[model samples]
Target: LRETRSYTWGLVIPDLTNFGFASIARSLEAHCREAGIQLLIACSEDDPALEQRVVDNLISRQVDGLIVASSGHSDDIYARIHDRLPVVQLDRHIGESRLPMVISDACKATAELVRDMASECGAEIYYFGGLLDLSPSRHRLAGYELGLHRAGLEADPARVRHRDYQPSSGYQLMAELVAELGAPPRGLFTASFTLLEGV
Candidate 1:
């Protein structure tokens, strides 16, 4: 939008091997290049402390802006950078911070997925993902129930699983659901990309 070319940007991510994160970073790199900007990509290995350190490093390098994709270190990182540069939060949020955000509509996606599962397979819907401590987890669960209700089906509390958005957590919950329900729900919607790996 700034009709400028040849800017510099810092791309901070939790991990590089994560396909989703890498794809996002590459997309940003491509966009920057196409717009005549240069991007420096960095990874923090999902460690908040490392992310904070990376933030300082990037700032010192004098990058024009930052793209933080759901970091464990977002709160502190953004707090340090917000006053001086543009920081776009993707797939996460820090309350009341004046940072711009670009994120998928997770809640809406969850609701629609559940509703579709209910229709396609006549299956009981389960909402699974994220730590209970996270707002997105809570919101996605709410969306699941709301979607079920909209589809004229009430969510069976027994069918819903809450996990820590990890593959092991997802495996455990899937096992638990099978144990309790005596089978899979015919369709499962996972809010966590990691969980999807297990599913």
Candidate 2:
């Protein structure tokens, strides 16, 4: 009897409806094809239980590796699978696992970008951010504050708004900001592309 080799990887992300995630999936798929590996993709829609189910399904399929853009759950679902196969965390991480991870330097970059925008605008700047519960959103908000401080500008509570990372939330928040300020700020920084579209 001969054993067949498995060269398949599993990827679990929040949602492909977001262009960013879709682009990542496309790139991963292309890379896998070039390397003669099969790619299995799943969307968790930012739900913890859903993510777990997806991971379990991937494990049952006997994937060579797993990549997760985590849902910030505290459970050790990924850890349990670690001994069977390699696991890599992407973007966000689970509560306190020491799993290998690939995360962006969003904080420093965001701060620099905001500083440049403020310099160009020469007026008050406003931040339209995502839900505070998420790590990325929290980091970006910290960056926004750091940028204002570095630019010698004070943080204004009225100029900072947090909402779901959705276009409708962005639109509604922008409308409220406009009504409150009577005009758009000279500089507006949105945390996500979908939110930017609404603004």
- Each prediction's TM-score against the native? 0.80, 0.91
- Candidate 1 lDDT score at position 157: 79
Q: Stretches of candidate 1 above 4 Å error?
A: 1-6, 72-80, 121-123
Which numbered prediction scores highest in TM-score against the true structure? Answer: 2
Candidate 1 lDDT tens digits, 25-135: 889889889988899988876556787788789888878888876545236657667777788887666554467878776678777877877887554667676665445
- lDDT for model 1 comes to 0.74
Evaluated at residue 135, the lDDT of candidate 1 is 51
Tens digits of per-residue lDDT for model 2 on 118-186?
A: 788744788999868777887888888888878877778877888887788889989998888798878
- Give lDDT per model, in order: 0.74, 0.84
Candidate 2 local Cα displacement, residue 160, angstroms: 1.7
Tell me the spans in candidate 2 whose CA falls farther than 4 Å from its real position: 1-5
